[model samples]
Target: MASKQIQCEICFKEYAVGYCKTCGHIGDACVDIHNTGKVFQTHSVIMHEAVNVHEDDRENPKVIIRDASEERCKQHATERAIFLCTRHDTMICGRCLHSEHLSCGKEVVDLLREVGSIDCEKVNTMKSLLMEVKNEILLLKDDAENSKENFKTNADNCAQECIELGIKIKQRVDELTNVLIDEITKKHNENESTYSRITRTYNEKITWCENEERKIDQFVHNNMAGYLYLLSRKFDKGVSDVRSNLREIKHKHTFKRFEFKENRVILKCVFEDLEDVCEHQDEVTGSDDGSVNDVFEPTTEIQKTRRELTALSHKAKEYLDKSIKERLTVEAELKRTKADLNRVEKEIIDN
Candidate 1:
C-alpha cells in the first residue's frame, strides 16, 4: 500500500506524518523555507537584525517587534505598498526604500512631500477655532466658579440677616412684655388701694350709724324718726362716693388693655418706630456683546439670563467630559506615534 503525504500551508515542503518533521509544525511541510519568495527573504533579514536589538535585556519583546514593524512600515509605505500593508497607512520615505524594501516592487508616494506643497489655510482656520473654543471653556469655568462663590456669599448674608433680625425681634418682644407687666402691676396696685380705702370708709360710716342708733334707743319714743332720716342720708352719700371710685377703677382697668394691640404679635408691636429692611441684587451678562443688566426678579430678561446660565453650565460640564475624552484619545495617539518613532530610530541603529 502507498502512503499519502500532506503539504504545509506556508512552506509547501511535503512530509509523511501529522506534523512537519523538519519545522515541528502541525503540517507535513518545511515551513521555514517555503513560498515566501525574495521579498520575504529581505524582510526576514531585516527582522533578524531588528530582533537582536538590545540583546542585553530579555524583557520588552515589543521593543524589538515594534522596531521591526516600523522599519517595515517605512520601507514598504509607497502609495501602492501602503495600500497593501495594513500596518503603516502612509507613504514610505526615501530612506526606507533602500534600507528595508530592497526587493519589493510596490510603487510608493511621498505623503510628507505632497503635504509640504499643499495650501493649509483651512487647517489653520480649524486650529484657530479649536483654540477659541478652548479659551471659551476656560473663561466659562472661571465665571461659574465666581458665580458660585457669589451665591454662597449672598446666602451667607441672608443667613446673617435672619439671625440678626431674629435677635432684634426677641429683644423687642422681651422689652414690650416687661413694660406690659409693669403697667398691669401699677394699675392693679392703684385699684387695690382705692378698694381698700372705700371699704374702710364704709366700716367707719356703719360704726357711726350704730353709735347714733344706740343713743336714739335711749330716747326711743322722742328722736327715732329724725335719727333714721339723718342716718339714711349719710349712708346714701357714702354709697355714691364708693360707686364713683369703682367706676374710676374700671376706667383704669380699660387703660391697662391699651398696652396690647388687636391681632398683632408682641414682637411686632410698634412702640419705638422699628422697621425691617431687606435688599437684593441681580446682575446678568450677555455672552455675545458682554452686555450687563441689573434688575430685580420677575423680569423677563432676568429670568431668561438665569435659564441661559443654567443651560450654559450644563453644556459646559458636558463639553468638559467630551474634551477630556478627546484629549485622552489624542494623547494616546501621540504616545503611539512617539513609540513608533522610537522603534524606527532603534531599527535604524540596528540596521
Candidate 2:
C-alpha cells in the first residue's frame, strides 16, 4: 500500500497529501502534468470536488485556484483547455487531441504558445488610433458648439438690424405723410382766402350799380325841361361810366376764374408728381444736402458686413457637414478598435 501511494505529476515523487504543491494538482492520485492520456481522469474527480466545495462556500466568495484558471472542457469536464484548433478555430482540452483533433492534420497548436506570439505593438497602435479619433471627435464637438453659438448670435444681430430698418421706414413714411398733409392744407387756405376776396369785391360793385340806377330814376321823374335836359347829359355820362366799370369788372372776374382753374390744375399736378417722388425716393435728388440719400441707402459698412456674414454662414454650414461625417467615421473606427481591443484582452486573459 505504501508503494502504491499517489505520486506527484511533475516531480514523479510519491505524495500522501491531497494537494501537490509541486505540480499544482489537487487529488489523491496525480497524472503526468504534461501528458494528456491520464490527466483527464485524475483532474476530473479533483476539480468536481473543488467546484462543489466552491459552490458551498459561496457565502465567503473566496478566490480559488480553479477559479483563476481556464474553464474546463465540455467533453472532459475537469481538464482545462490547453490547445487551440486553428482549423476549426475552437479551444479543446488534452483529451480532445486524440478524440476530436486526431484527423485535424496538425492544425492544433498550444493555446499558450499562440497567445504568447501575439504582437502587443499592434494593440498599442490600435489604442493610439482610438485616442487620436477620440481627440478629433472632441475637437469637432467643440467646434460644433461654437458654431451653434455664433449662428445664434449672427441671427440675433440680423433680426435686430431688420427691426431697426423697419422702424426707420415707418418713420420715413410718417414724415412723408405729414409733409403731404401740410401742402394740401396750405393750398386749401389760399384758395379759401381768394374766394373771400373775390366775393367782397363783387358785392361792392353791385351796390354801386344799384345806387346809380336810383339817381337816374329820380332825374327822369322831374317836370322842368331845362333841368331835365341838363340831367339827361349827366345821366348819359353816368350811364357810360357805369358801362365801362361793368365791362372792366367782368373782364377781371373772367381772368380770376381762369386763374382759379389753373390753380386747381396745378394742385392736381403737384399730387401726381408727389406720387412719383415718393415711389422713387432713392433715385430722386432733393435738397442737395445728402440727407435724403442717407435715408434711402444703407451704410457701406453695414452692407459689407452683411455680405461677409452671409459667406461665413455658408462656410460654417459646409464645415459642419464635413465635421459630422468625419465624426461619424471616427466613431465607427473607434467602435471597431474597441472590439478588437476587447478581443485582445480576452485572448490574453484566456491564455
Candidate 3:
C-alpha cells in the first residue's frame, strides 16, 4: 500500500507517514514551530534596531502595536486612545490622562476592558425609555389631530355666528331707514296737500275781489250815481269779507316747511355699539392666547364653546411640549446605546 502524504503549511514541503524529519510533525507540532519561528524573526529585527538606535528612539513594540491596532483620540489626534474617561464620557489617550483628566474625579477605565464589560441591563433600560417615549409621541400625535379637528369646528361655528350677526345688523339698519323714509314721505304728502288747499282758497278770494272792483268801475262809468251809492256799501262789504277771508287763509295755511327731528345721535350711538360688538367678536375669534373666555364674555353657548376650545388648545400645547421632550430624551439615549453597541460589537470582533 502507498504511504499517506501531507504538506507542511509554513514550509510547503511534502511529507510521508504524517511527519517530516526536517519540519517536525504535520499537525500541532509543526504549527507551534512555525509560530515560534515568526516570533524569533520579529525579535531579531527588534534587537538589530535596538543596537543601532538610541534608548529614547527605541519605541516599545507593544505601544507601536497598540497605536497601530486602535483608533486615535479625536482630541489628541496623533495619540492612540487607551482609556475611557467615564466622567467626561469620552475616549482618551495616555497623554490626556496626565493632562486634562488628571483631576476629573472619575474612573478612567481601559477602553478594551470597558468595552468588554458592557452591561446588557443598561441597554435594556435605554430600550425601555425609548419605547415609553415613542408611545407618548404617538399619543401626542393623536391628541394633536383631535385638537386640529376641534379647532376647525370651533372656527366654523364662530364664522357662522359672525355672518348671522352681520345679517341681523344690516336688517336692523334697513328697517330703521325704511321707517324714517316712510314717515318723512307721509309728512311731505300731507304738507303738499295743505299748501295746495291754501293756494286754491287764496286764488278764489282774489277772483271774487276782482269781480267786485269791476262792478264798481262799471257803475262809476255809466254815471249811475244813485245805484252806485246804493251798491257802494255792498261792494265795500264784499271787499271787506274777501280781505278777511284772505287774512284767515294766510293765518291758517302759511307755508310751513317740514322738518324731520330724527334721533340721529341715537342712531349713531347704536352704530357705535354695533361696531363695538364687531370688535369684540374679532377679539374673541382671533385670540390665540387661550383667553377666549376673557375676550368673549361667556353669556351664551357659543362663548362657552369657544372657551372650551381654547382650553383644549392649551392642553394640546402642553402635551405637545411633553411629547417633544420625551422624544429628545429618547433620541439622546438611543444615540448613546448605539455607540455602546458599536463598541461592544467592535470588541467582540477584536477578541
Candidate 4:
C-alpha cells in the first residue's frame, strides 16, 4: 500500500508526515498565501498584496505580514510569524524574529542589509493607509465640532425665545397693572375733598366744645354757692352758654369713614392659575372694590414657547447622541490605525 502524504499549504510541498519537512510549519497552515493574496513580493508583477490585514483590522489595518508568502500569526497578532525560507525573505516583529529564529545565537540574517532592499510599493501602501486614517480622524473632529456648535446655537435660541416670552408677559402684566392702579388713583382722589371737608367740620365743633368746657370748669370752681342753688340765674346762664356753643355744631353734616373693600385673594388666585385667568375674571372681579378696577396673565404664549424650546432641546439631544456615537466609532478606528502605524514604523527602523 502507498503511504499517505499531506501537502504544506505555504510552499505547496507534499510531505509524508503531518508537519512540513522542509520549512517549519507544524500541523496547521499559518497563512493561505494563494487564498488571502495579501503579501508583498520581490517580483514586480506582485504575487500578493503587501500586507496581510485581517477583516477585523480592515478599518485600521496593521501589517501582519510584510513579504509575499511570508506568514504571520493572525490569531495572536501581538505575536505574528513569517514563512520559513533559506533566503530569509520573511518580515516579522523583533520579538518573533528573536524567539523563533535567532534565539540560539545564530547570526543568520542582517536586518540592516534587508532594509535597503525594502520594496517601494510597500512604503507607498503604508503611506496610503495612513492618509486614509488621517482623513478619518479629521472627519471625526469636524463632526464633533459641528455638533457642539449646533447644540449651542439651538440652546441659545431656545433660551432667547423663553426670555422674549417672559419680557412680553411682563409688559402685558405691567400694562394691566397700570390700568388698575390708575383706576384706584381716580377713585381714591374722588374721596379726597369729602375727607378734607369732614375733617375741617370736626375740628370746628371740637374747638367750640373745648372753649365751653374750660368756661364751665372755671365758673363751677369760682361759684360753689351757685352750684348748690338749683333755681339760680347762674344755672340759667350756664344753660344759655351751652345752647350757644351747640348752635354752631347743629345743622352740620355727619361724617362716614372713607374705606375700600377687597374681594378676597382673588388677584393671587388669578395669577397662580394664570392659564385660567380670563376664565376666572368674572369670579375675580368685584364692584371694583366699590372704588373702581383690573390684570393680565400671559399663559398661552408662554406654554407655546416652552413647547418649542422642548422640541429644540430634543432635536439637539439627538444630534449630540448621533455625534457621540460616530465619534466613538471613529476614535476606535483611529486608535487601531495609530497602533498599526507605530508597528510599521518600528519594523522599518529595525529592518
* Candidate with more favorable, higher TM-score: 1 or 4: 1
Reference-based lDDT, residue 301, model 3: 34
Backbone clash tally for model 3? 0
lDDT of 2 at 17: 33
lDDT tens per residue, model 3, 233-341: 6877877887888788778865546676768987796667565574434223224663332454433433434458779999999999999999999999999999999
Q: What TM value does model 4 have?
A: 0.29
Q: What's the TM-score of each model vs. the native? A: 0.36, 0.36, 0.54, 0.29
Worst 10 residues of 1 by lDDT: 60-69
Model 1 spans with C-alpha error above 4 angstroms = 1-136, 169-182, 209-280, 284-294, 297-351
Question: Could you give candidate 1's per-residue lDDT for residues 1-351 as a string of tens digits?
Answer: 111233433455543233222222222233333335444343222111123334543442222222121222433332122222124334454555566544554444444433344368978999999999999999988988987898789789889988898798889789978988898888878767767766776576677668766765755667668776666678667667756756765554332223545556543545322432334456554445665444447433233344587799999999999999999999999999999999999999999
- Give per-model CA RMSD: 32.2, 31.4, 31.7, 34.5
Candidate 4 local lDDT, 178-208, one digit each (tens): 9878877776676576567656766766776
lDDT of 1: 0.55
Kindly give the number of clashing pairs for every candidate.
3, 0, 0, 2
What is the lDDT of every predicted structure here?
0.55, 0.61, 0.66, 0.54
Q: In terms of TM-score, which candidate is strongest? A: 3
Q: Which candidate is the best by lDDT?
A: 3
